[model samples]
Target: MPHSLLAVPPSRGGVVPALLAEGREVTGSHLRELAARLAPPMDAVAAYHFGWIDQHGDPSAGDAGKAVRPALALLSARAAGAAAEVAAPGAVAVELVHNFSLLHDDLMDGDTTRRHRPTAWTVHGPSQAILTGDALLTLAVDVLTRVPEPEIARRATARLSSATRGLIDGQAQDLSFEARVSVGVEECLAMEGRKTGDLLGCSAAIGAVLAGADEPTADRLHTFGHDLGLAFQAVDDLLGIWGAEERTGKPRWSDLRRRKKSLPVAAALERDCPAARRLADLYAEPEPPEGETEDRLAHLAELVEEAGGRSWTEDKARALYRSALGALDGVDMPFGVREEFTAFAAFVIGRDN
Candidate 1:
């Protein structure tokens, strides 16, 4: 069984769960109502994705990723000194939007596995998968519209729309980078900032704004979210290269196999090594032999280290964590919230899965 929320320390000064609990109280009924309105096929697909049903819509067991976005929404509200429970619908809306993106991204990437199970696209066809993703996006908006105030709903929708557009832009850049021979660390960071960072930043900012935070306060929270997100992506990059397949549930050397232009690869370009040169040579090769693939993978990792990718990533994560914590430095945090937030940050970077 997955670890219970009660098992782990909170991520943001023991505020994550208090906020999450509030959102959950509102969300359970709201989500069930929304789920009831979805058409059968679409409902089946979404239910499966949410771990509420099997591929055939029968009851089954599955799991979802940490609802990080929702936590951000709730925490942002708390940071602004509001009852985050009052903004629960907004929190659920962001979570739905995030899940919708994950569904579409899995289809676009032809990724078969997620959370140790076949992705929606893997079991269903691309058309159904695409429809499912679209439906989720629509549901997110629907959830936002029910947030009890037209103006709040409108602002939340606008922010979400912008975040979604940024995600697409980032994904486009990521796919395009695969074909380009020259990619740099700066470009990689920009791509991640847009693709991954913006959504996270917006989640926190929108929450704060909805809770009536001043512009400066909201902006600080936004910065914190962006830094945390960038650090999260760096950790993810490291896992993609060296994480255990059993833990990560991804194919070993998956990035290398795809010739992905990740941060480590960008770092390696700064060095002049035979292995680095060989990686450049092999980039365009249609298919590399196993022996050669292993050799190249090992060398590329070495080159990345030599070029200081790991050190840079570590430093960046630490700096971001500090910044995130600093944002809360003088704020009167709720009981145990600080410890939870610190533990959460460490868990994110230290995770092998």
Candidate 2:
């Protein structure tokens, strides 16, 4: 019952992260309050985007995306010894910024659906969606600044601003990769960090800053978030190529069609296999007619698997997750909270959509 897709993913096996329910409850309340404060059409647009209201302003249970990032933020605060109530603003700010990125990204990527629902840009038109995204980003900062303590507010804002800048640069790198003839695995990995990891790193550590946590604690938490984000993106890349359109709310083979040079593709290209060469050939050709695309993409997917792209990416994801959880060693926190984190990390890597 929230908007925005996952930094983690949808809960499964009934293993919801600790404080996730509280995170959703509080973040949802704040989001609704913030949406009400926006101007007339923008408020309506924002509400529609969040699945709180339909295109005609009626309520719907349509795909609202999982509220994983906000939950993670609140968990970070709880781990750092702050009450969930006290750190709610930090959680909400992280949610807003993430959604802002989604709004722009959906439009720029020309994605038509997410979570089995029409993307905001498609329903409301691209211009309105862009403006709404801009509004959400601004709102995130405003929410942070409203925190009662001036120093905490400043620290939170600065950390978030730095992350946003890195995210933008990552976006640039991502787009540039699409136009290039070749890309390296290491470079794509670095780009993935900037685009996906930086904000998540901020989300993980921001609550610590808000709670007046020391530098060492915040830094380790940042690493926790950053590595987790990379693991999340690996799953996303797999979904982009192989996910069911109905389950993922994305067009099938969208990434391969775009020849976007995702991790799998980059790694596969490095292989010395026949499929690798053919996959490269396919990537260079312009997309065929819509009717012909499915089989072509299917073959392309097979080739990627044959070249061992899929398996490598999966192994890398699990490895990144291990590194992420390893960052928590010696971090002072509740044992229960630490247990919840381990379960949550497992859940993130295990989620199918």
**lDDT at position 349, candidate 2:** 76
**Which residue runs does candidate 2 get wrong by more than 4 Å?**
1-18, 290-292
Q: What are the runs in model 1 whose C-alpha is more than 4 Å off?
A: 1-29, 289-303, 327-343
Question: What digit string (tens of lDDT, one per residue) describes model 1 on residues 1-353?
Answer: 11111222334444444544555555656665676677867777777777777777788767656667777777777677677675676677777777788888887766787777889877777777778778878888887777676776677777778777888899899989977986888899999988888788777767777776666776777777777778778777776666667777776666676677787777766567765666667665766554446667766666656666656666666676677667656545466545655665555555567
Q: Residue 52, candidate 1: how far off, in angstroms?
A: 1.9
Total clashes in model 2, counting residue pairs 3 or more apart in sequence or in different chains: 0
